[model samples]
Target: MSGTAELAIDAAFAARLFDELAARTGDAPGITRAAYGEGEQIAHDMMIREAQALGLTHRIDPAGNLYLTYEGRDPALKPWVVGSHLDSVPHGGNFDGAAGVIAGLCAVRALIEAGLRPRRSITVMAIRAEESNWFPLSYLGSRAALGLLPAESLSTPRSDTGLSLRAHMSRLGLDPARVGVGQVHLDPAELHGFIELHIEQGPVLEAAQVPVGFVTGIAGSFRYRAARILGEWGHSGAVPRGHRHDAVFALADLITALDRLWGEVLEGGESATITFGEIGTDPALHGFSKVPGEAGFCLDVRSPSPACLERIHAGLLHIVAGIEAARGVRFNLGARSGSAPARLDEALRARLAAVAEGCGAGFTELASGAGHDTAVFANAGVPAALVFLRNQNGSHNPDEAMEMADFAVGADILARLLARDDND
Candidate 1:
């Protein structure tokens, strides 16, 4: 087969692998490849098998990240890493994390078939535990691999299994002691660059009729994981209009105020989003006859602009204070998890754009509202960027969909990008 034909065949094979992995891990609901669990481990083994089939060497880092290496002319030079995570949220769609890794695999295969050697090694990495659904944490693998995770977080227990992250890693034969100690971390200075290919997980690309998008930046976000409001319980029917302090009412008022604040922020020519995903009243303390005495809720606010996030957060604080006084309730909101926005490396972005144009593919520039492993690497001082393939039905569900043609286009771009020399 000609080199171009061989590359095309590999790209098709990568797309098929997505179907096989998804079928193996999940069925009716969606993908259930939880981090350090049986399903995820199965997926990782498949990745390693594919790497070996392609004549690449594979190894697992201390944080449980998998790296498949293609040797270059100079072994000592830093590697150009291309990959994404293999784990998924419960019932999440197949393409969320797996597409990038598959694309990297195809890209490396294409380079090998063409018999091209660059100055630095090329590695296809399968990062671990990127979804926050299972562990109440995002970027678990990438952060630990970069030594950016807080040392104390290793022993923190998870909500689902009551097992700390360290325990989970130990169960999987990864040493927790090596995490954050520079022993398991990928040094920033030792990386030539990083690129990740992913499904858009939103409507932007599909709406624009574009096959791919060059990400300008990833949004920063703040989470109020365990926010509580306290008020005195009272008889629901007997209390006068001004006599009772209802925690549920207070929470309603706060939500309304935040909605209005969101509009104000949008009017100010900045992009931002806020979500109150979970809320509830204490089950044991309340009934239909009594006013709710305590309420708990979670909040998530995101923006590509740091200034916009600050402004929206300030508005939230002001709204909380007003609601507390007006409704006679106490508010206790604490920080849970957050990371700042990450801008893509400009030089690498230009190369991706050029490759897309050369392939005669339609493209656009956009900002990713959802966070990805690329942002983590970018924030850690590695030159990083992301390419988003058009996807529909959003993500984190069984209905998520993307065209195989789009996937092939993205894989081609990645192949061309990886094969290019810096001076070329």
Candidate 2:
């Protein structure tokens, strides 16, 4: 096939893969491909087959990360790795990780079809357990790859669910003892670069009438769990409103204030988001006697800029201080997840931007507010950049959608980028 014909064919295959996984949304919510679930394995199987068909060798690391390598003409240069993760949030969109995986596969296919091997090796990864809702360790695959995970992590118990992560490793017929096997040793400048193509997962691309976006930086995240204040539990009529500390009542006030802070953060010229996701209280507030004990809620904040994040952090401290004084209640706060801001490899980003323009695709630049495996690599000092495909209206929701044509366009851009010289 001609060069143009080959690019078109591989791009079409990527689009088909998106449709195949996206159509699996059963009902009521977004994707449920939590770590090591059936859905996750299905996605992995398809990717393996696709890689095998294209004549690439595949290996599943002890961490469930799938690496597919295609030999290049030159054996001396470090491999050029292109990929993203495959696991999704509880109800995440299909294009988030799957699109990146298929796009890399397509890019390699396009290159091979053109019969042009690179000056370096090409490795494609479909990392596992990035969502981390079920597992305590987020970025499970990348951590294993970089040897960033501690030995204690392997022995950490899973949630109430029967699937312990180490058990999952064993089921795959791999030894958990080999969990951090290949990651320990690495050359600082070893990898030419790592690139990820993912859905924008926000409305920016579609709103701007663009097809692709580049990541200039990635946001830092702060996940906090805070306890609420509660007054004594008594008969509804027995105690006066002023006398009760009602933990839920106090929590309700904080929730509303934080909700309002979200809008304020957006107006301050920073891409920031806050989610007050989970809440719990003591005693059954429903049925018979209203048992009242302690009530707590989780809060998460994200911002693409480090300076902006610090501002938000300061504002949060102010809010917490005020609550402590006015309510006479201690504001218990602790972080469950937090990561410093990450900047993309500028040279790598320039390369992709040039390729996007060459493909004649409308493009825009953006900072990723969502965390991913790419962010993890950058954290580990591996130079990395991201290409974000346009996300339809919804992303983490079950109704998440994106145009197939956009996927095809993104594949073309990735192929062009991979076909370029890294050290150039």
Candidate 3:
């Protein structure tokens, strides 16, 4: 138990937690743990039960963020906080955010089983509402905990329920009044460091046949969730091609323009991704015989470079203007929301790589194209690091296939990192 090879993770415990989560929150195609909803509450309650069983002290913040701490021998040192969000997208795979919290819990369990106490306490945080699909805001729970969430954000409505964030918090018996006042539950200066373990959510590690990855940085994003195009509805057979003002055609033009712009950006030695995730015509207002007069869509753009984001945004505006003038349509893009790109802690990343090597875990250094709560922590100057475990079939879907063995490797690295006494 003293050597790196002997350190072990409680995989059985992790498995039970995962199984229970999927069983309780199971939707049709996959699992659904909506942020600040019933499913997410089930996951949080499960974690609380497990923490109590592990003899850990637990606390819940006003924003409904849960923290479970395993005390160390020393009281003066800043504790290491390890975890990710518990909420998932609609019909999303179970392992996306849950893996990080389970990994943290397993790491602490390993130390306790080995009869070793580190100098700094270890706290596993189960963050609320990381999925922007539920709420339009990015990194909602993390930003609120850090006191960086704007007061106006409290009035933003949840997409599904159409309830304001403040109202939702009240439903959960949480203190939204305190949350709106910019109260800080987690101060950056008081933390030793933050570590988040998540599924790769892409094909990088899977294609490379690697078990894990230490992220160098995370991409920032700008999203318009309630964008719409408006035109006049007319008879399909009666309206001439030139005289028609079709919203569907206008949307198509916009998509095509953005795709071309995305390619140009890539060709110019810039990295960026643009996605139109949701697009459709209103079922209640439209008919097969009539030209569609309105369409709603969502736009998401991400890049690690701030300049790239701005350039694409400008391109988008230009495209919108051209389409409006030509198609005789009006574009109404609702309130814009986004997050800044984050550069993780290089020193902590190096230390993790060393630990991975020492533990015989295969790892590679890469940049994350997907957004994560780790970005929030790093941008807040918390010395954060994101560890990605290899998975198949991508993420945010029903087919996310993360092997238990790969999870163990990532958990082992976390355990070893937290078990060490010396702080670099």
Best by TM-score: 3
List, residue by residue over 145-249, the lDDT tens digit for candidate 2.
777776766765545465677777777666677764445533336887788988887889989999889889888887774445544455565666666546566
Compose the digit string of candidate 3's lDDT tens values, residues 131-248.
Answer: 9888888999999889988898899888899999999999999998899899999999999999999999889998889999999999999999889999989999999999988999
Candidate 2, lDDT over the whole model? 0.74
Candidate 2: Cα lDDT at 159 = 53
Global lDDT of each candidate? 0.86, 0.74, 0.92
Clashing pairs in 2: 29-398, 30-91, 30-398, 31-91, 229-247, 230-247, 231-245, 231-246
Candidate 3 has its poorest 10 consecutive residues by lDDT at 1-10
- How many clashes in each structure? 0, 8, 0
Q: How would you order the candidates by lDDT, starting with the best?
A: 3, 1, 2
Candidate number with the higher TM-score (2 or 3): 3
Name the candidate that leads on lDDT.
Answer: 3
Tell me, what's the RMSD of every candidate? Answer: 2.1, 3.2, 1.4
